[model samples]
Target: MEDVLELYEQPYDPQQPVVCFDERPCQLIGDVRTPLPIKLGSARRVDYEYERHGMGNVFGYFDGLAQFCGRN
Candidate 1:
């Protein structure tokens, strides 16, 4: 929307700071098999299959004016 875009376009001000916050539900996953170690010029190889261990909540906070971020 125009209102959201206009808010983002405003210059950063320390006193009147702009902050954004978001959260996500993350699925904890694990490999079915032990991954192959990395070799020269090659990266570690993972299996095509995975196992779901549990769920987790991820939160993010950002201050546009101070260019600061925090995560949990």
Candidate 2:
């Protein structure tokens, strides 16, 4: 909405800092076994096998006042 966008246009206010939050559901996966380490003349390798651990959530936070946001 226009109101949300307007918040970012205003000058930073430490007293009334604006913060946003979001989260994404994720499936957690893990390796079944230890990976093979690389040797002097050999290439490192990983097994094709994997195991599902459980469900999780990835969260994100943004600070409009500090102009600080992080994501890939």
Candidate 3:
């Protein structure tokens, strides 16, 4: 990134917006079913399990000049 920025510095303004474009896929998982109810004397609990499915692709556009752009 520094090399590219240096090369472009001659033509592109440092203060100008130099944006970066990228995309990524995110995955989500969840349990199949909730746990069964327990008897009066026994303990009862509800739990869920999750499995990963194909995630969707996300697109991002970023500029170097922006102060508050990307935050993870």
lDDT, candidate 2, 8-62, per-residue tens: 7887767787888899999999999999888998888999999999999999987
lDDT for model 3 comes to 0.65
TM-scores of the candidates in the order shown: 0.54, 0.67, 0.43
* Per-residue alpha-carbon lDDT of candidate 3 for residues 20-72, written as tens digits (9 for 90 to 100): 77998888666667768788888877665667766888999865445334422
Output the lDDT of residue 18, model 3: 70
The local distance difference test score of model 2 is 0.82
Alpha-carbon lDDT, every model: 0.81, 0.82, 0.65
Model 2 worst lDDT run, 10 consecutive residues: 63-72
- Candidate 2's TM-score reads 0.67
Best by lDDT: 2
lDDT of 1 by residue, 1-72 (tens): 899779878876667778788999999999899999999999889889999999999999878546633321
Clashes of 1: 0
Best candidate, TM-score-wise? 2
